[model samples]
Target: MAKLENLVQLLDRSLSLHGPRPLFGTKADGRWSWITYAEFGQLVARFRGGLASLGVQRGDRVALISNNRVEWAVAAYACFSMGVAVVPMYEAQLPAEWAFIINDCEASVAIVATPQIYEKCRDLPEKAPSLKHIVCLFEPEGPDGAPGARTTSYGALLAAGEKGPAPAIDPTAADTACLIYTSGTTGNPKGVILSHGNIASNVCAVLDLIPFGSADRSLSFLPWTHSFGHTGELHVMITVGASMALSESVDKIVANLAEVHPTVLMSVPRIFCRIYEGVQKQMTEKPALVQGLFRAGLRAAARQNKGEALGLVERLTLAAADRVIFSKIRDKFGGKLKYAISGGAALSYEVAEFVDALGITVYEGYGLTETSPVVAVNYPGARRLGTVGKPIPGVRVEIDRSETHDSRQGEIVVYGPNVMVGYHKRDEENKAVMMEDGGFRTGDLGYLDEDGYLHVTGRIKEQYKLENGKYVAPSPIEDKLKLSPLINNAMVYGDNRLFNVALIVPEMTALSEWARGEGLTFDSPGAMLRHPRVIARVQAEVDRCSSDAKGFEKIKKVALTDEDFTAENGMLTPTLKLKRRVVLAKYAPVLDALYSGSTKAAPREAAPPG
Candidate 1:
C-alpha cells in the first residue's frame, strides 16, 4: 500500500498524471461527447460549484439514485470534491427503496440518475422532509419528479455551477466519502460507509492487476450503484487515465466492443456464459464432419492447456480448428480485447477456460462490498484456475479462527486497509464480527491451499447435511448443473434425506425450441415439461449432474419449476446471487410436491448454476 495521506490528494495526483486526457466519453443520441483531462478538471470544479449552489456543505449527506452511466461518475466526483458523503442506491430500486435509503442517509441532496428515479422520490421528501435538492441526469418518465419539487437537470445544474465559486474542500482521509448500501436478502439494506482512503487504497490495488493507463480504452456498463462497477472499473479507469466508452445499454455491449475495441473489459459471468452458448449454437449448423473436427480440436486444446504435449496429429488438428473456427470467435471481442476481469460472482469455470483458449486472459477475483469490494484478484501475469488468487497488495487475509466447519473447510476471513470503516450507525452489529485487530469474518466457507490461494467451497449460512451427516456444498453442484445446456438453474435440496434432490429451471428460449422440434403443443410451452419426452430428457440431465458425486451427495430426484428465480420474487439478490432461505420459502410447495413421491402433475412451465 502506498500509504496515501488522503483521497482528495490521490484524485489530484491522478489528474496530474493523466491530466485532461479523455476522462470520460459517451454517445448521446448517437453523437459522442468526451471530456478531456483539462475538461475533466473544469467539470469537477463545476460539479462542486453546483453542489455549493444547492447549499451542500462539507460532511452533508447527498444520496444518488441512478443507473450505470458516465453521468453517475460525474455526480460522484462532485460529491467527493466537497467532502460531502455520497449515498448511491441502485436504479432498480422502487420508490419505497429510495425512501429507505434517503431516510437512512438523511440526505440533504438527492441526485437521480434519470427523471424516472426522480419521480420515484416524489413521496420521499414529503415523508422525510430531510431531502432538499433533486438533481436529474435524464428526463425519466414518471408520475412526479423528486421531492420538495426541487428538480434540476445536469445541464441546468452545470449552468448553476458556472455562477458559483468552487468549494475549497480540504478533506482528510478520515472523512466519509461514500455510503453504498448492501443488497439485503433479509431486511432493508445497511449503509456501508467507505472513507476516501478505503476506496482510493482499494483502487490502487486494482491498478496493480489490470495494466491499463490513460492510453488504454475501456467500456463501462456495470451499474455504478454496485461496488464492482464503481471501484473495480470506474475508479481504476479514472486513476489510469483510460478512455471510457460509456455504453448506453447492455444490449449494445457487442456493438461497443466492435466500435471501441476496449483493452479492458469487465463483466459478470452471465455475459461470457451467454457468448459461449451462442458460439456453440452457431457451430451446430456446420457439417457433422466439420463439427466433429472442431470438438476434437477443443479437446486437444484442453489437453495442451494442462501441459500434456499433444501428438503431432492432435496439434495439427487443433491448430487447423483454431485458425479457421476459434479465430472468428476471438474477433467478436473486437480482436483487441486484453484483460477480462470477472467478478461480482464466479465466472463459470468452463467460461473462464474457453476464453483463455481464445488467447484472451480472463482473470477471476473475489471480494465483498464491505471490503471496499476487493481483497484478492488474479493479475495477468499472476493467475491460477482453481483459486481466487492471493490477497492484493496491502490486504491481510486469514481463515476465521472461530469458524465451525468439517475438517475439509472453514470460513474465510480478511483484514486490511481496503476494509470499510463500519456499517453506518450500526455500532452494535459492527462490534459483533469486526475484530479489534481489524479482521472481518467473511461468511464464505473455504480453506486456503498451501500456495495461499483462496478456494471458496460454500456459503457458511447455506450449509445443509445429508441423512448420513455428511455436508453438501451447493455451489459445486450448482456450477456443475449449469454446465448442462438444458439446465438453466438448479437448487440442490435434501437437507435431511438419504441423498440430494434439486429444483430445476430451464432456459426458456432453448427449451422452447426443443419442445417445438419434439412436436409438443400447449397453451403455454411450460405445460409441455410434463410430456414424457421432456421428463426423460430432464431426467437424463439430472443424472448427469449427480454422475460424479458420491451416494450421499448424489441428486436422486428433481422437479422442474416454471418461473425464473429473480430479485423481484425475493429469490435472488440484486447482484444475481441466490438467496437460499428466500428461495426455499418461496418454493416450499414445489419442494414438497417434488418429494411427495407422486408422478402425477402438470409442468406449469420452467429456469443456471452460479
Candidate 2:
C-alpha cells in the first residue's frame, strides 16, 4: 500500500485500501455472484501459498490455459504475487501450440479452466519436461479415466495454501510478470517477455488519460490470454477499482450487455462492424418514413460531431430524431455505455463513422503484443475520426521511412517502458526486431500527422507486389469490403499475379434477408454460394466496395463461402485477426482454380470512371 511499484504491490493496495468492495461479477446457476476485493485478495494469497508449496519458487514459470473467468484472474494475480511469471495460452489454440508454449517457456505448473482443456494438454508433462503439476479449476476429473497423478483440483490447491505459511511478495519493476505468446500470423508464436513495469506503465498511462474509477463497471468478453484484454481491460479496471463482470462468451455479449448495463465496453472492430450491420439491416426493414427519420438523426449527429452549431429548428429536429432512432440503438448496448474502445485490428472508416452517428463514441487504439499492447489511443477530448491518437505519455514513436518510397509513411518503431524486454530465449528473433537504440520495430506501416495522431496504413509483411510491379496492401481492401453489410470476412490474394482476387465470407443474417426479398431459397450456405443469382449479388457488392481502390488492388474474382474465419478453424487468431497463411493453405484449391480461369464466373476489371 506504500506507493505501489510493481504489479503485486498494486494488487495488495487494491485489496487493503479498497477492502470489501465488489471487484468481479461472475454468473453461475442462472445467477450472478460478486467477489469483493478482500475475498479476491485472500484467494490470491492462498493460491500463491499453494503454488509455493508445490515448489513454484520465485522466477519459476507457470502456464494457464483457460477462457475468461473469475478464477483466471485469481490465478494470474496469485502468480504475480509470488514473482512467478505467468504464461497465458489461448484455450482455443491447437494442442500442439499449447505444448510448444509450455515447453518454450519452461513452465513448471499448468492451471487450466476445465477437464476438457486439461485433456488437450494431458501429455504436457512428457512434452514439457519442466511441467511438474497440473491444476484444474473445475472439480478434478480426467477424460475417459480418473485424474492423472500430477493433476489436482483448484480448490484442493487453495486449501493446501490456506494451511501453509503466508506467500512471499517481493518483486522489482524489472522482474518479468508475464510471458504472452503472440498469435503468429507468419510463423510460430514468440513469447513476449513483459516485465512488471511494462504492463504497469500501460495501465498508469491509460488511467492518466481516461477517467475510470470505482463508479465504473464493465462486461468483459475479450480473451484474457491476449495482451490487449489482459493489460487494457482487466489490469486497467483493477488498478482503478472498477467493477467487472466476466462475460460468458462472445456470442452472448448482447444478452450480457442488457443484463449488466455496464458503464464501459472494450472490444474489437468485429463487434462494432456487426452492430453497425445489424442496425443497418433493421433500418432497411423499416418503413420509408422511419428510415428518413433515422437518416435525419445521423445527419444531425454528424454535424454535432464536426462541431457545427445547430440552428433552433435543426436542434429541435435533432432532439426528436435522437428520441425516436438513436435511443433504440443505445438501448441495444444496455443504454448506459459511456464509450466503447476498439482495438486488436484496424477499424473500418465507415463503421467508425456510422457508430459515431449513433451517438456512441468508439475510441480506436493501435498496438502490438510486444508493446504491452497499447502504444496510442484516442482519449475523449483529443480524438480524430480515423486516426489512432497520440502516443501515451513516456512512449516514443518514430517513422522509419528508410525503406519506403514515401517519406511520410514507414514502419512504426516504438521505444517505451511498455516495450517488452525481448522475445524469451529467441535471441535471433529478438535481434531482428530490436533496434540499436532499444526501440522495437513494430512492422506496421503508418504515418503520424502534424497533430501527432497515428494513422495505420497496413502491415509491412502483408503487402505484396503484383506481376505488373504494383504493390497492394490487402488489409485496406479487406477492411473496405467488410464495410458492406453483405460481407463479413474477406481475404485478398494476388501476390505476383496479374490482379487481386478475394475469398469472401458472407454475412449470413443480412444475406438471408436479401435472399428472402429476392424470392431465393437455399437449404444450405454452400448451395447458396453456388447459386448464380447469389453470386451475382455478391459480385455487385464487391465492385461497389472496391470502386475507390487502385486498379491492381481491386478484387477481380471472388469465391463466396458461408463459413466464417474463426479461432476454432485455425483461420483466425484469438484476437480475431485473420491468419493469412492458414487461410491460403485451407483454400488453396479454390485460389488455384480462381487464377486458372477454370471457374465459370467472369473476372471483373477495375476501370476509371468515364
Candidate 3:
C-alpha cells in the first residue's frame, strides 16, 4: 500500500483495492443486508454531490446527528471526501447541547437521522444562524413531523444529487476533516478539530500494530459519533477491507454477536465487565461439577495468560479444559472471535484476564479525542496485562512531571501527527492544554513502565483533597468497587472532607435476586435503596472491594441508590463516562448526610456471596 497523503486518497485507494468486497452490513426486517465497497463509494459520491448542491464547499462545517447507522458512515465520508469538516453529535443529547455545538462549529449544513432528531434541532437556525440546510435520513410522517422550512428528505437530496455536478475540491492533509466535541464531564463540550493528516496518521499507525484483513469481520455497536468508534472501528475496518455489521442497538449486542459471528469485536470496558458478570452469574446456577471444571480451566488459563511456563500436567489439563469448558464460553462469542479491542475507559484487570483465559485476546488501548483517539494500544504479540501497551509507531509519549505532586507519575502528554490541530475557536483553552513544545497534554495521570507500557492511574482533574490534606484518585477506587457484581456504578466523594465516601448504584438484577433469597421486598427503587438490608449488603461489598486501598483511600461510608447514572439523566456522558461534577451536584444531599455523620449504620452480618 502506498503512503496515503490524505483521507480522500485513502478512501479512493481502498475502493480500488476492495471494490467487490462487502464493506458494511445491517439488520432490517429480521434479515441481514450487505453493501459492497463499490456500492458504498457510489453512495458517498452521491452524498458528496448532494452536499455540494446545498452549497457545502471546502472549509464548510457539516453537523451530523445520528446513532450508529449506515447513513452516519456515508455522511461522514462524504463530508471528508469533499473537504468539508464533519461535526458529529450524539442524537440523544439535549437540544441545548445540539444548539451549542451547532453554533460553536458554525455548521452551514446538518444531516439528521430521523424526524425526531430533526424536530429536536428544528429551531437550530434560530440559535445557529450559520446553519442553512437540514437534511433528514428518513422521511417525515406528516407536515407537522417535518422540521423547519429548510428541511428536506434524505432520499430527495440524493435524487437532486443525481442531477447535480460532482463536487471538485482539493484538500491538504492539514485541512480539518472533523471536529469531535468532548463529552463535557466538567464543563461545556469543546470541539477538538482533527485534521485529515491527524486521523490518517492514526489509522496507519494502528494498522501497523493491530492485524486486520479482508477475512476479518467486526460487529460495531459503539456510538459512531465518538472518536474511539469513529477512528478505531469504522475508519480502521474500512481501511483494512474488513466487513462491519452495524448492530441494531447496544441492548441487542449479545444477540447480534451470534447472528453476525464477527471475527473481531471493538467495545468499551463496560460491555466486557457485563459479560464477565453474566458468565459468573450463569456459572453459579450450574451444577457443582460444572462449576468446578470451569474454575479449573480458568486457573490453568490464568497461569498461561500471566506468561508463566505451564508444567506438562498443567498444559494437558488446560488442553482438556479448553475442549470441555473454555470452548463453550468461546462459543457464546460465535466460536470464531479472534480479537476483542477494549477502549473508552480502563478495562478492569479481572475482566481482561477472564476474557484472555477464554482464548480471546483483549487489547486495551488508551487515547483521547485530541490525539485522533489512539496514542497507545496492546498488539497481538506485545500485550501487557495491566498496562495500556506501547505507543503506536511515530507517536511520542512523555510523562510530564512538573505538574504532579508525586514524582512517580504525571500527566501523559503526546507529540505526534495524530494529535489534533487544536480545539476549534477556543484559543485560550487550547493554550491551556497545549504544552510548550506542541505536545497535547492529556489530563490523564500515568507513567511508562520500564518495558514502555503505559499505566494510566487516574485523571489529574478528578483527584480530590481530603480534610487531612490527602489527595485521593477516585477512578482506581471506583474501578475496584465496580468489580463487585452487586455494584454497577460508583462515584467516590469527599473533596475536602474527613474521609472518602461513595454513592453506589447497585446492580439491580443481582440485588433483586439476593433480596428474594433474603425474603426482602420493596415496591420502588427508592424504597429498596433505603432498606436497611440493602444498605448493609452494599457497605459490606464496598469494604471488601476497597480492601487493597490505603487507609485514606478506603471508602469510609457509602449510600446506595437504585438509579444508575445515565446520559439521559445528565450524570453520565453520551459515551457512558461519568460526569463527576454533574453527579456530585445530583447527589449533594446524600454526600452531606454521609459527611455530617447522619448515615453511618453498621453493616449487617450476612454478606452477599461473590
Candidate 4:
C-alpha cells in the first residue's frame, strides 16, 4: 500500500506529472483560460520564496482567506513546500469569525485576496499577538485603502521571494500540514490540525478506488475551506495528472459544467436534489401526453431494476424516453459526466435512486472534517441505495451504541492514518478524544451492516430528549421533510414535550413562485409562509412525511422561519448543517408559540419547568 510520507508530496508529484499539460484552468475571458504544469510549479516556487522573505519559516501558521481562485491553490502548494501549516478561512465568514480563527490558530502571516477580507480581521495582531504580516493576493490600486499596519502587496512578496534564499525544507508526514477550522456548532471554531500524512494517506488510498487519467477533466465549485473539496477535488485531481476547470460559483456550475464537460463531478446533496426537483417540476407542468410518457418510463424502470432481464419493448420505450426527456436533463450537468459523487451531507435515496435510474451513477461519501473527511463512500463497486459503503482500505469504522446485536453500530469512530493529529495545541482536549493508539471518535451515529458497509444515522450529540424522557434523532426526520421541493431546509425538535415539532424554511424562490402560479398573493417568504393555502400545502406534505416516522420522530407541529438559518446568523455551521443547540436556542420563542398552539396542533407546550 502506498503511504503518505508528507501531504506536500501531492504538490511535487502533481507539478511533475503531465508537465506540459494544463493543470489549472481559469477564465482569461468569458469562456477561456490557460494552464501548464510547468507554469504552476513556477508560481508555487515564487509564492514560497515570497512567504519566506516575509520571515515565514517552518512550522509557522499561514492564514489564507480568499475566494476559490487559482492563486489560492498555488498558495497552498507553496506553503506545503515550505513546511508551513496553512489555515483556510471561508471568505463567507463574518468579520468576527474571521478574527476569532486568526487568533485561535496563532497565524503568523496572511494571504488575502481582497482588502475587504483583510479588514474583516484588520486588528488581528492585537487579538492574535502572533500575526506578523498580511499579503494581498490580488492586484491593488495604491494599496486600495488597506490597513497600513504590517501589510504588503502580493506583487512585492513575489519580487522579494524571487531573490530570497530557499530555506532547507525537511517536512515529513507526521508534521502538521494544515489546520482546518470547522465552524463550530458552538460560538467559536475548532482548528482541526491535520498532519501531512493524514491528508496524504487518504489521497493515496483514494487512488485505489478512483482511477484518474490525463483525459479526465474536473469542474470544481466546492470551496477549498472544506476538506472534501480541498483533497478530493483539488489534490486528487492534481495527483492523477488530470485537468481541472475552476467553477465560477455554485450559481454558474450547471452552465460551467456544460462548457467544461467534466468527466467526474463532485457535489453536495442539496445540489443534486435541487436538480431532481427542477426535473420533477417540469414534468408536473408538462402536457398530459409527456407526463404519461414519463410515468411509463418510471414504470418500466421499476420492472427492470437490480440487473433484472428487461423485456425488449419495455427497454425500447425507456430508451426512447431517455433520449427525448432525460437526455436534456443530463445535458444541464454536462452530458459527458461519467459519475457524480455526493459528500458533506446525506443525500435522499429518492434523489440518489432517481439519478441512478437516469443512467448517471451517483455515489455518496460519509465523513466529518475531522476525519480528513472520508471514512466511507458508496461507490459502484459496492453501492446500495441507503448505505454509505464499507470503510475504505486501511480505515476502520465502528458505530457505537449497538442494540446488543453486535451490529457494529454507534457514533462512527474511525482508526486510520487519515485521522487528524488533533485540534491544535489542545493536548488535554486531544487526549480526551483521540485514542492512545490513534482512533478518533466521530460524534456521528451509525451502524455497519453484515457486509461491513457503514450506514450513518444521525449525530449522537444532536439527539434531544422530550419532557416524557423520550429521545429523537432529527436528521432523518429533517431529511424526509426537505424532499418537498418547497421546503429548502428543516430542523426538527421535541425531545421533552408530548411530541415533535419543526421550524420549516420554505424555498422562498420556489414557494413564492409556486404560490404565484397558484394565484396566491405574497411579497416575502414570511407572507407566503402564512397564506392559508400555502400552509395547507406544506402541512399536507408534512403529514405525508410524518406517517412514515415513529410518533416521537414525527413533526406534529411546525413554524415557518422568516429568513434563512445561515452561518452569519449563528444558526448554521459553515457546512450548512443546522446547529441544533443554537437553532433551538434562537427559535425558542417561536417554538413556544408553536407549543402555544399557533400551529393548531393537539400537543400544546406544557407549562415551563420552575
lDDT of each: 0.76, 0.84, 0.86, 0.77
lDDT for each residue of candidate 1 in 369-397, tens digit (9 for 90 to 100)? 88888988887666777677778988988
lDDT of 3 by residue, 326-369 (tens): 88878878788999899988998888999999999989999999
| Error in Å for residue 316 of model 3 | 3.0
Candidate 2 per-residue lDDT, tens place, 370-446, comes to 99989999997888888888999889999999877887999999999999999999999899999899899999999
lDDT for position 61 in model 2 = 91
Task: Give the clashing residue pairs of candidate 3, or none.
Answer: none
Which candidate do you rate higher for lDDT, 3 or 4? 3
Local distance difference test, candidate 4: 0.77
Off by over 4 Å in 1: 1-6, 29-33, 139-149, 303-311, 599-610
lDDT by residue (tens digit), candidate 4, 1-610 = 2555775666676666678888878865786586788888887788788888878888888889886788898788788888889899888777677678888888888788886776665666666777778788766556434343477877787777778746536588777888999877754678998888888888787778766667888888888789998888888788888888988887888888898888888888878887888888889999998888777776676556466678888899898878778788778778888777888888877788778777777778887778887888876567776777777778997655643233455667799888987887678778767887678878777888888777787777777788876667788778888888778777887766788878887777776777878988855455566666777777777888667777667677777765567777667776677887777666676777777778621111221221
Clashing residue pair totals per candidate (backbone < 3 A) = 12, 0, 0, 11
How much RMSD separates candidate 1 from the native structure? 3.1
Better of 1 and 2 by lDDT: 2
- Provide the global lDDT of candidate 2 against the true structure: 0.84
TM match of model 2 to true structure: 0.95
